[model samples]
Target: MDINRMQDKIIAEFENLATAVNKFSYFRHLKKISNGSQPMDPEDKNDRNLVTGCSRKVWVTAYKEDGRIFFKADSEHSITRGLVNLLLKVYSGHTVSTITNTDLYFLHEIKLFNYLSASWMRDFLSVIQRIKSLAIVQHLDAAPRS
Candidate 1:
């Protein structure tokens, strides 16, 4: 996928998400959503509900229907939950190849990656690698299914 197109699409989609929360707004939302909510289930996984590595344990459940990927995810940390929502808002409904091969540089473009802690940076990269890895796996899975 083209970088410009990808970024443009992300921006558009995020803008449409009502509040379009950035880090601050996200934290605000997280604080509100942190009222002892249970984590989402990983047992009910479908084809796309997977994330490989993360500092805070996370479960991403995805379903690609009608050429749109719908994702439901949860995590232990408030910030992680927020991040999951952010990721789903963009990558949830896209095809494995559309997600994997794209130049979807999300961190900087999203304007939140810049404020990340050094430790969080490592976690962030790991999570991203996990997503890419899964996308690649699914792409291969879609190949012949032999």
Candidate 2:
């Protein structure tokens, strides 16, 4: 699905839940997606990709495939892992322009910012920034050297 649709879907899912308990319940279900993502290898979990400021260790790696970005992430915490999975689902398999240009309002619409503490939310925002930075670097690398 396109990024906007995916964002809408996430918002809808969270909107379906009326209470904090229900939201947490739905978040637990996101673990299934997290479990299905590829695990980060020990070598891939180095400090370069390790997301700092999070309560738990979260590592992310990105590469370009067929002009689209792909991401791999691993986190010690299930909720963080699921958040990574959610981001990968939206940004992966999309071109750099799409990745960098897309507006990520779903994060707020889903109330993730409200649900998570300031530090945890910062970690999540950092993950998004890292993803965009990787996309920018990849885009520059793919450009023809003049």
Candidate 3:
């Protein structure tokens, strides 16, 4: 699925929930699901994969398969994990160009900024930067050595 469609699906899911508390519950639910389905390897939780500038410890790892970038991330904080999972849902399995070019408008559409504290929002932005940087590294590594 494309990024916009995935984002729209998330927005729709949020639209069903009537309250801020329910929205937070939804994030926890996403975190639980991500924990079960995408456990980060212990080796991958090292310094190289660790995302800096975040209040929490978040690790993001990326690799390319069949010319598409895939990411696996884990965070010490549940809400942070859920937020990153949301990003992964949209960005993973996309080409480097697609991932780099796409703008994540879902954050505003879902009104996520209202729920986040300044530190958490900063952490979220850091996670996004980490994902993009990893995608760029994958792209450079895949380039032909002319």
Candidate 4:
């Protein structure tokens, strides 16, 4: 599915949870599922992939295959990991241009900022910046040398 549709589906899922606590619980559940299935490789935890702004240790790595970008991420904190997983669900398996250009309306649609601490939000934005930076690098690398 496209990014917007994926984001809308997530918003609908979150909307089904009536309370903030329920939404938070859903994130924890997502974290558990994400960790079980896609544990980050030890090599990917290096400084090169580590996202620096987060108080919790977070690592994000990106690769391009068949002209689509894919992201894999892990975090020391459960909520952070879940949040990253949420972003990965929306942004992964897309072209570099698509990833970079898309406006992340889901963040607002789900009212995520209201639940998270300022520092956590900053960290989350850093994760996004890292993803976009990786996408930009991939675009540049793929460009024909003038």
Give the winner by TM-score.
3
Q: Model 1, poorest ten-residue lDDT window?
A: 30-39
lDDT of 4 by residue, 1-146 (tens): 89999999989877776565565576666566467437789888998899878888999988888889888899878778888888988889999889989999998988888778789889999999999998888778877898
Per-residue lDDT of model 3, residues 1-146, tens digit only:
98889989988877776665565576666566457548889989898888999889999999999999999999877768888888998899999999989988888987888778799899989998989999999989998998
Give the winner by lDDT: 1 or 4. 4
> Which candidate should be chosen as best, given lDDT against the real structure?
3
What lDDT score belongs to each candidate, Candidate 1 first? 0.58, 0.82, 0.85, 0.84
Q: Give per-residue lDDT, candidate 4, residue 57.
A: 91
Clashing residue pairs found in predicted model 4: none
TM-score of each: 0.62, 0.85, 0.90, 0.88
- The deviation in Å at residue 105 for candidate 4 is 1.0
Question: Of 2 and 4, which scores higher on lDDT?
Answer: 4
| Per-residue lDDT over 13-83 for candidate 2, one digit per residue giving the tens place of the 0 to 100 score | 76776655555576776676679787778899888888766667988888887888888888988888998
Worst 10 residues of 2 by lDDT: 17-26
Candidate 3, residue 7: how far the Cα is off, in Å: 0.8
* Alpha carbon deviation, residue 82, candidate 4 (Å): 0.3
TM-score result, candidate 3: 0.90
The list of candidate 3 runs beyond 4 A from truth reads 19-37
User: What lDDT, from 0 to 1, does candidate 2 have?
Assistant: 0.82
